[model samples]
Target: MYNIGIDLGGTNIAVGIVTKEGKVLKKTSVPARAERPFDQIFADMASCIRQLFAETGIKESEIESIGIGTPGCIDTEKGILIFAGNFKYGKNIDYRAEMAKHFDIPVYIGNDANVAALAEVRAGAAKGVKNAIMITLGTGVGGGIIIDGKIFEGAYSAAGELGHIVLISNGEQCSCGRKGCWEAYASVTALVRQTKAAMLANPDSIMNKTPLEQVSGRTAFDAAKKGDKAALAVVDQYQEYITEGLADMINIFSPEVIVVGGGISKEGDYLLNPVREKIKSRVFGIGLLPDRKILPAELGNDAGIIGAAMLHA
Candidate 1:
């Protein structure tokens, strides 16, 4: 039997047909345009599935279930997306119920981070590990926690919000309406802000060559490679903060591995190596590093859809 995975994000809706082994056989993408009517956007999302069905010629009866990874608080028991910051969805949006009008398959919903973690453990970076955590750094921060081989969502499917943890008391305010959140310091958004702040200090910095609006998470790393002191400082500080945050997570879970994903993970070793070393140095207990490790995520963007499809697995 096959499964359908839908990745509903802020700007795009991606639907795919996935096999039990976590491979996507067919997939398509469409604009979500979440600012429009909820039902309308959902219709377009459903249409993508229909288009896939037509192209693949797969009968509805062959599909076992449908899994969705959404960017917000998911009421798993109710299949309701409680809220979505980027998607602008409100509470009580019966997402599964609305989609049910189109197909009769079983539907499972989960937080994007949690679902991504599920995907990793099933077939990606953490495949063989018993316990792992996935941290996705993007416009904001998203995370998933796994313990004893199952997702540890705690209560209300809100347990793995690793980004909102207090990092620096009374420091930068976060989108979650809190101050000193780890997300405020370690996210790509925070990296951009940090790069900009350093650029303002060093007029002759290599980053000045680019428009301020175009400066991205890679700006500091790019300029630092050219031996710019300002850029190097920003990179160092960013890594330091990320190290502390990883240390905090290590203290809490001490999982076999910590998987880092999202746009920033593209940096690969340049990012993961330093953070791992720092975490190794700062975490509780003093001794040589054991089997615990921090590795960059392997699945890339497909993690969302594949993980979503595995919801029923």
Candidate 2:
């Protein structure tokens, strides 16, 4: 039987018809226009699902279940979106019941990052692995932890917040209102900040050619590739910050693999090789335990849909 997956984002609601093995048979999306009421958003979701079925000529009976990967803290058992700052609508919205208004099918909900991690473990970078951690380095750092082939949602269904761990006391400020959080140091936002700072301090650097407003996560990495000394220093420091958090995660979970996703992972080995080398010494008993592999996420944008579809598994 097929499963339907919904990737509900602030900007778009993406729906997909997926096979048991995580392949997307058909997919489509609708604008979320999140400022609207929750009811209207869900109606659009149902409409999109129906449209997919019409386009694919698939019947409702062929669908085994429907799953949604949404932003914010999710009450999976209750199907509630506890809080999502990006949405104008207030918290505690019942998502499962809302979708159920359209279809009589078992629906599951999971945090977007968690589902993405599930996608990696089941079909992407960590495929065939029973235990893994996926870290997404985007505007902020997002984490998904899987143990024994299942998502490890802790009490209150809010575990896997790896980025909030403090990397330094009284250090840089973070969006989570914490000082010195790992995300404040290692996220792509932080990388851009560091790049701008280095460019300002070293006017001769290759990155300074770009206007400060145009500086982005790729600015430093791109300059470093050309052997720019200041840019290289910025990249080295950024990688160290990333390694610090990764080492801590390794010491804590010791998962078989760590899958790096999101925008930065696009750099591939250029971004991971140095972190891998640096992590060797930081992890405890590095030689005694089998080496943990770090890999880029393979599913890319499809991970959200594929992972949401597998929530029942």
Candidate 3:
């Protein structure tokens, strides 16, 4: 049987027909148009799903379930999107019920980051692992935790908010309205912020060697590779903050694996090696420290869609 997975993001909605073995048989993308009415976005989504089925020549009788990964807080049991900042029109929408009404199939929905992490655990990087945590260091840091192969959604369905955890006392403010959150200093946006600040501080530095618009994680990597001191320093600073957060997670959860995903993870060993080393060296319970291995996410962008599909399982 086939399963349908939908990645309902801020910009676009991606749908796919996935196999039981986690292979995507067919996939397509359509504009989310979140600025428009919720009904319009839902209609686009329905059309996308129907197109996917037609392309795959799969009938409704052959489908097992449909899973949706949406941004923001969600009431999984009720299939309601409580607060999705990306979609101004999605708040309080009963997505599962609506989708079920249109498709007549079992529907499952959850927070996007949580479902992405769950997908990696089930079929991506963390496959075969019993316990792990996932961190997506993107525009902001998003987190998810898996224990015994199941996602640990806290009592309020907001568990695994690793990024919002306090790292510094009354320091940088976060989008969550808190101060000194780990994400404020460890995300890709944070990296860019740090890079820009450093460049401004040392106008003569090689970072000023590149155009501001071209500055990104890769830019930092390129400069570091060229032995640019300022860029190296920025990377060092970012990694230090990231390590502190991971070390705390290691101490608390003792997870067997930590899967780092998102654009920053493209740095691969450049990012994972140092974070792993720092966690190993600094964590409190040294002897009892779990067999923590930091690995890059394998599924890339598809993890969210694939993971969302498995929510019904």
Candidate 4:
């Protein structure tokens, strides 16, 4: 039977029909218009699902379940979204009840990062592994942990927030209201901030040519590739920040694989290689155990949908 996966984001609500093996058969999306009431957003999601059903000529009875991957805190046991930073009015939303109003199929919900990790373990980079960790370095860092091939939500279904772990005390402030969070140093947003600061310090740097407002996650990496000293410094420091957290994770969990996702991971080996090399010295008992693999995520954007669909698996 087919499963429905919904990737609910600030800008869009993407829905897909996925097979048991995690392949998306058909997908469609609608603008989330997050400023509106939660009921309106739910209505749009239901309407989109109906449209998918009509376009694919699939009977409702053929669907096994509907799962959602959403941002912010999720109470999966009750299918409630506790809080979402992007939405204007999403608080303690009973998502399962909302979906129940439209479809009788079983409903499941998970934190977006958690589901992405699940997708990787089920069909992407860590497909064959039973233990893995996924880190998404976007506006903020997002993390997911898998143990024994299942998502570990901890006691409150709020575990695996690896980004909030502090790497430096009283250093850079984080959006999460913490000081020196790993996200404050290792996220793509952090990279942009670092690039801007570097350009400001080195007026003659190649990166200075771009307006500060235009500085992005790639600014430093691009300039560094061109052999710009200031840019290289920024990239080097950012890589070290990433490695510090990775080493901590390795020492704590010792997972078989750590999958890197999000915009910055697109840098591929340029990013992974340095982090992997540096992580070697930081992990505990480094040479005594088999080397852990740090790999870029393979599924890209599809990871959220495929992972959400596999919630039933």
lDDT score at residue 248, model 4, on the 0-100 scale: 88
The worst-scoring run of ten residues by lDDT in candidate 1 lies at: 283-292
Tens-digit per-residue lDDT, 32-83, candidate 4: 8889988888888899889989999987899999999999887899889998
lDDT against the true structure, each candidate:
0.87, 0.92, 0.86, 0.91
Worst ten in a row by lDDT for model 2: 81-90
Total clashing pairs for each candidate: 0, 0, 0, 0
- Evaluation by lDDT, superior candidate among 3 and 4: 4
Per-residue lDDT of candidate 2, residues 1-313 (tens digit): 9999999887888999999999999999988898998899888988888999999999999999899998888798988989986667569998878888999988999999999999999989999999899999999999999999999999878999988999999899999898999999999999999999999899999999989999989999999999999999999999999999999988999999999999889999999999999999989997898779989999998888999999987
Candidate 1 accuracy as lDDT: 0.87
The superposed Cα distance between candidate 1 and the true structure at residue 202, in angstroms, equals 1.8
- Quote the positional error of residue 208 for candidate 3 in Å: 0.8
Per residue, candidate 3 scores C-alpha lDDT tens digits across 173-256 of 898899999999998888888988888887877888778877887767778778888888888889899999998888788778
Model 4: lDDT equals 0.91
Better of 2 and 4 by TM-score: 2
Maximum-TM-score candidate: 2
Ranking of all candidate structures by their TM-score, best first? 2, 4, 3, 1
Candidates arranged by lDDT, highest first: 2, 4, 1, 3
